[model samples]
Target: MSGTSPSVAAGAGQLPGTGRTAVVTGASSGIGAATARRLAAEGFDVVVGARRLNRLEALAASIGGRALPLDVTEPASVAAFTAALDRVDVLVNNAGGAFDAAPVAEADLDSWARTYEVNVLGTVRLTKALLPKLRASGAGDVLFVGSTAGLVSYEGGASYTAAKHGVHTLAETLRLELCGEPVRVIETAPGMVRTEEFSLNRTGSQERADAVYRGVREPLVAEDVADCIAWALTRPHHVNVDLLVVRPRAQAAQHKVHRDPPDRTAAR
Candidate 1:
């Protein structure tokens, strides 16, 4: 449990994450990819899974871990992914994203359904499929990469908000249901993350995505969230972090973000 740790978030420099197998879903880019790399560096035998086989393979090669083609929204794909693993010490459910930024009245049902299917049900499918392996491992960990959208609602985030809320509920219920089990269920809710795909995919344009973080100072990056995940996972087996909500200093809330003036002290 000792190594020359990379510069990550607080507590990430502690004991290395050795003698474990960590499965990271949606590891093609953003937070998922970063987490996979960080965990591998921490000493876990990492498994990067995503629908994009090429990206997955490349990431796996760079990290010296294995790659599996996985689509969490598809049961068969999840089953196949599960079959590839004989042991799962950690399952990082990070395969979810927002679809659109429309108001509830104008929200597209298809978009909403996609959001729910990927965010809530995707996590459920993987967690259920890997439960036995986790239990058998004796120090199993299930970590969900949730969002702040789950905690609060916004004007144009009805679909994503609802879906993330479901994720929150799922994590909470699973923890309660598995109270006596040896596994630990943890959730990390990040806010205002400036990933290339998240905002771009939601708006379907580079302009809109850029606007999401324009003039914002030091918005949370994928690496920041990954650091948090690694820190939580590396803790002692008895310590279980139920839910961790992280946000940048400029992001006070979903609606109360400090957008104007760029800096509060600038006006002074």
Candidate 2:
């Protein structure tokens, strides 16, 4: 994908946020928050959902959308969240993370289960709950904020990779199953993104999180991935972007990445 960011309209409602409503999970920050803002700017009534009510409220206020407290891992929370939404034209499943960086032999079962619960089961629950609404839109879109890990495995990433692989499979299967329906299933897998909380949450340390992109000149930002999602959603109703794998130029693959050398090898 091109690194160029998609331009937003002049002002809010410049394009449409009425009539079409988008529900974004994990909208408190990172990719989810960026997507919620982008969709709102594109004239979609945006509902930002996350367990952090305060952050969601703040984001909602900034984007002129609604805020709903939601914990995707909890069935009751998902039900309550869906109950609050009257209609949904777009659903962005982005509430997922890596609990611990451990190899399979040293994996923590709890972490593995948590990863699956949040990444796979949670996505399934929300998708099932909103299927009717999506079908009703006549051009509904279901987008998953997957990861490069979903497409490729790495050392000490068994749990997260496995969970993300499930996400990829889920998206693919849903697209096939919903072939005739108006709903579209799209997945955007990003690599080496430097978000504020993603790495911190995964590694549980500021130092490690900082080290993730220490020498990388330009890692993919959340907005970059969000732009891809918005572009896919705005396409013709008949067109469906099945899967989009996005990574910064420095990151050629899941295992291969080129970092600047002491700020002198930046040109390389």
The residue pairs in collision within model 1 are none
Give the alpha carbon lDDT tens digit for every residue of 1-268 in model 2.
Answer: 3222222212343453346888999999999999999988777889999999999999999999999999988899989988888889889999999889988999899999999999999999999999999998777889998988999999999999999999999999999999899888999899988899988988999999988897887898999998888877776566778889999999999888987776564545
TM-score of 1: 0.92
Relative to the true structure, candidate 2 reaches a TM of 0.92
Residue-wise lDDT of candidate 1 within 1-268, one digit each (tens)? 2223432212444435667899999999999999999999888899999999999999999999999999999999999999989999899999999989999878799999999999989889999999999999888899999889899988899999999999998899999999989899999999999987999999999998988887777899999899899888877777888999999998988876776564663553
Query: Candidate 1 at residue 170, lDDT?
Result: 89
Off by over 4 Å in 2: 1-18, 263-268
Backbone clash tally for model 2? 4
